[model samples]
Target: MAGMKKLLIALMMAVAAPTHAEVFAKGADIGWLPQMEATGYKFYDSDGKEEDCFRILKDHGINTIRLRTWVHPSNDRASGHNSKDETVAMALRAQRWGMRVMIDFHYSDSWADPQQQRKPAAWEGHDFPQLLDDVYNYTHEVMQALKQAGVTPEWVQVGNETRTGMIYPEGHTDNWPQLAQLINRGYDAIKAVSPSSKVVLHLDRGNDNAWFRTWFDNAQKYGAKYDVIGMSYYPFWLDGRPDYSESISDLGANLNDMAARYDKEVMVVEVGGVDTEPQNTYDMLLAVQRKVADVPGGKGLGVIYWEPQGARSWSHYELSAWGADGRPTKAMEAFRVKLGDK
Candidate 1:
């Protein structure tokens, strides 16, 4: 009777576990692909043949593309350039390429990060309950649109790099219960529109295991339902150095620890390589791949490179590996390389 009861309890526990888990995602944020192509930014293959940006990334073994969506982004010339329409269009192209897609919701009119979590202009002056309704309706609308387009995302981040929280002081960590309520509402909306989509709770500083523990513990305490733990790992610039020799090792350890502690699939949702040291970028990416793939209990989802094609333009994001000829640098070899067991 005791053995039978134990088996029943184990089965019940298994049934209670979260069902969705993100698979290993070799991804890149090519949200700029449409805009770049629109501007005549022709990308070339490694064979020196002109091709579309999506095909080039496909050639490099990228299996997924991450795109960001802002709720009614403004054209105020402040770099808040993304829109839901662009993301939906990008998702269509990624689907055409047989690539999985992840949509990061900024939950703001513009960027929402650790330092700033600005509420959308439309949501301003709303009370907490009204704000929750706004998040739910907006999230549901985005997912519903994707569902209509037949390009529903495989993963949807509730907010982008939301370290402090999302949607300003109302949704910030200072108000944990409110933040949890907002995040939960977003989660409910995503599931309502597309049950297959896995929800991600994203934060910056992937190497900082301590911060992740505190934030997630508080989240669990407040009853936030999420599937994946997405983190940003920008070792080169984020750590105030060009050499990432020591940083990479610490990063790997942190990834492992986060997986073991949280029992949720972890992903480096945003990463980058420096222009000056593309080789270092390659090494760092390779290390991240191997490390994430080695997470305890096989809970690592994978890493996504942030804007690997932003080079040789007026934008001139220094971390991009793209060259003047509109092809990826040698550092992109990281995506193509094979990894052995760690």
Candidate 2:
């Protein structure tokens, strides 16, 4: 009977092994680090016992938390907002609760959207090489602080929505080599401090795979090395309202091709289906998740909702009175379908 049990265990192990262990057995590299600070989303213990939010996330199949960092936010005590300090607190909470984190450095005081990329106050007067050092030191300091607090991140993004370059004139890279170096400085700093942590180059416009190929290919030529490619997808914003099929298929095809082309995995870093009442965009969002899950190479690893709780008003830099109670809507429920055979 003992021998029979041993054989059974051996068979189970055999079934678990894959032909290409690097891609298959290694599992999906989807970094589901959603920006909780911006969304006004909160997690509380049952009976209102006041448990940590990260613990709640771990219970719900979430393994990562993504936090954004701003260099020097306004000293507005009235609103009680401080991106740099607040993010570190969130990181500490996640670490204590046994969750991983990914830090996104905007390198600016306020929001760094595709439209505007302002230079940080401290970096305003610095030259190009000095600016690179400043970037390195700032990133190094933040990562080191996390390390000292016993909250090393699993991943770090050099810049947020960096369709344009970072640091304006000094660190901006219209040319590939210049931009690649600026990005590389942040990457190098993270690796130097935490060797195992993965570095990501996040981009916007998830539906456009060709754009991804062109940009990333250029980065690669200049020796840009990143473990995962992070993307943001919002149909209403990117492809207008309610075009689920096109968006998902586009994401699926893009991810497969990107994984094969660059020999790296792809993740939908920021995604949210607008569930504005009377609008009811939940079902459409579910369809997007379904299509993404069916993509080839199993390249579509994870899709993080950019704050399902951002019901009516959840701005990036301001705290509004908008929020949600109980579990997420049907659109949020659709995420379970993509959890697949883990």
lDDT of 2 at 215: 84
lDDT agreement with native, every candidate: 0.84, 0.63
- Angstrom error of the Cα, residue 23, model 2: value is 13
Each prediction's total of clashing residue pairs, residues at least 3 apart in sequence or on different chains, is 1, 0
Score candidate 2 by lDDT: 0.63
User: For each candidate, what TM-score against the reference?
Assistant: 0.90, 0.77
lDDT of 2 by residue, 1-342 (tens): 999999999999988875321221111111112344344445443344444444434444455567777787764432224365567777887667655677888778876767767888888888778878987888888888878777777667888777666667654547677778888888888888887777888888877887888888888899876788878776767644655555677777787787888888676767665453312344554555554555566665555555443334333411111134423344533433443533
Candidate 1 residue lDDT tens string, 1-342: 999999999999988875434346788997666667656677888788998888888888788899888887865433556787878888988899989899999998777788778898998899999999999999998898888899878899999988888888888899999999999999999999999898999988887878888999999899989999998888765646646666777778877777777688888999987776778888888888988888878788888998887764634678887887777988787888766733
Candidate 2: Cα lDDT at 118: 80
Taking all chains together, the TM-score of candidate 1 against the true structure is: 0.90
